[model samples]
Target: MSKETLTIEVSWPASLAVPEGSTIDIQLWAGNDKAGYSMIDGDFSTPATASPVTLEIPYDSQDLQSHDGTTTWDHFHTSPRLVHGGFIKNIAYAEKISVAQTKGAAWKMALR
Candidate 1:
């Protein structure tokens, strides 16, 4: 499989509540499931806006798969081939957000 650098820019809604100088963990999941192939995580000055992270990803036919009658795919495998057809798609997720503790302030998170 041919290899290339994949750059992804991640950001959050401006209306969302985010603490300044908090650490954010971003994960890149490929294919049809939650098994992530690559990840980039660090502490940034602003949690709402993050710099683009790059992943050395496989491309071309070896980067793709087809679910014919007998073809099988497993998430635990380390192969970069995640797409099930002729196209490539991926999912980006933000996780493990660390909030800075403030003196005399109460922290509350609303779940949707």
Candidate 2:
């Protein structure tokens, strides 16, 4: 299950008004076929510019250990607000990931 092939994009739109030194934390979680979920990867960074910060994460299905037993879908949790002075805005929704997409191919997750 070590499918080292998930791409995660963390970005802040230039149009959004964010404080100068604000930072955001993103946590990525994926679901197991069984009734559970696992945290795949996460990052905390400051978007000092308009370009997106890209992180290459491994799905590693073998690592599934039911971090959250209450959910059956793939989802991510973000920091409540930016570090400096503004609320972080999200542009994407959590979607259910299929077994094939979770174990076979690379998945692209963008958090804006």
Candidate 3:
């Protein structure tokens, strides 16, 4: 089953903090369709003058796979907290994704 095009903006109070030299490992979604996404395209970098800066990622993709059968990554990042991801673009598609909180963390799966 598909979910409604979802947009989630999760915020933490200034009191809540991440250690220095740490990046908020998060998944960014790009469209509205509950079709669990796999390959996504985006970028993250250490912000200049960084001080607990929240990175706002605006994304949009259509091909999202679900977890009914589980998925594997072709390549992965060194950071254990950083999950594996991938993607492709062309033709046309939808726009909203939902964030599923998993493993004491959050995985933003594009329901497209």
Candidate 4:
């Protein structure tokens, strides 16, 4: 996979509910602290029962993910890929990112 191919498609089942009082989000990464990307496009806190929302993330070096009210990617070797991620609160308690894909000339992801 090339740098351009570092795309991720995240979806949740329509039947299941996002954990009550919590939210779900997605992150796309080139590498830790390497200007990754993320977005929360769904009403994960209040999902619909009919259709599973699909979020097509368009990420790149230019559209880097950031915290602290910024769009820049997280800091080098940052604890959270997002600097000011609201989910940081969640990360304080649980694992938000379970799988991650590293994009380069070749691709690899978190193992099962």
Candidate 5:
């Protein structure tokens, strides 16, 4: 069993008002047919320039093995009210991800 790191990049609209050094909480969920589910939460700081922020999350071998080759993941911001929400469909393990909020207050999720 080998462990793998899942990297998720979250972005904010330039027009959005995000104060610098604000705490952003990310809630992530990954699940497969056999593994049932796994959840991880992390916090990151908003860069002064609103550049894309990245988060690295680690999953153990057991979790990876239980994935059954394909997995589905969803993530969203849990604080600061900056981002609305987002989700991803069937994907092979984890890859570079980018999440952002639309101007109309809707959230979007994508794999980068």
Candidate 6:
């Protein structure tokens, strides 16, 4: 089996209220499987006011399984002393491969 790296980007809504100096916990699950889990704990710091925030999370492709060329991913967020809940709807993960061909070469390699 080969390993691939995937980066998950999440855009946070500006309307969500977040306390200053508080940390936001982010969790990623592959489908409904509990074994396919990845977490970014306390990695996000809430600003003084709500604003659009983007988070870039990296994961191994082996950690997630795709069906029909698409994989279902779920994200959750919470703060200290707050109940953990889903932050957004289901996210679809598709495998994207880019290949570059060089001169004098009859073939190219797929890069993911």
Judging by lDDT against the true structure, name the best candidate.
Answer: 2
Off by over 4 Å in 6: 1-17, 32-50, 65-112
Please provide TM-scores, in order, for all candidate models, with all chains considered together.
0.29, 0.49, 0.30, 0.26, 0.46, 0.34
Each model's lDDT comes to 0.28, 0.48, 0.30, 0.30, 0.39, 0.32
Q: Mind giving the per-residue lDDT tens digits that candidate 6 earns over 21-85?
A: 43333444444323333333224322222233333444444444445536543422221221124
**How do the residues 67-104 of candidate 5 rate in per-residue lDDT, one tens digit apiece?**
46564343222222233222221122232222222112
Q: What's model 6's lDDT at 77?
A: 24
Model 1 alpha-carbon drift over 4 Å, by segment: 32-112
lDDT of 3 by residue, 31-91 (tens): 2344423544555433212333334444322223334434422211111121222212111
Q: Report the C-alpha lDDT of model 4 over 5-82, residue by residue, as the tens digit.
A: 232222333443344443333333422333334542222231222233233333444434444435544321212111
Local distance difference test, candidate 2: 0.48
Q: In model 1, how large is the Cα lDDT of residue 25?
A: 32
Predicted structure 2: clash tally: 0
Per-residue CA lDDT of model 2 for 9-102, tens digit only, reads 5555566665566554455655544333466554545453443555455455454445544434444332222345455544444544554553
Model 2: per-residue Cα lDDT at residue 109: 44
Winning model by TM-score = 2
Answer with 2 or 5, whichever has the higher TM-score: 2
Model 4: ten consecutive residues of lowest lDDT = 75-84
Candidate 1 residue lDDT tens string, 11-99: 33344444444333323222324443422222221132233322232233233233342322222112121122333222232222211
Off by over 4 Å in 5: 33-36, 41-49, 64-112
Tell me the deviation in Å of residue 48 in model 3. 11
Q: Residue 49 lDDT in model 2? A: 45
**For model 6, the run of ten residues with the poorest summed lDDT:** 102-111
After TM-score superposition, the amount by which residue 4's alpha carbon in candidate 1 deviates from its true location, in angstroms, is: 1.1
Clashing pairs in 4: 65-72, 65-73, 67-84
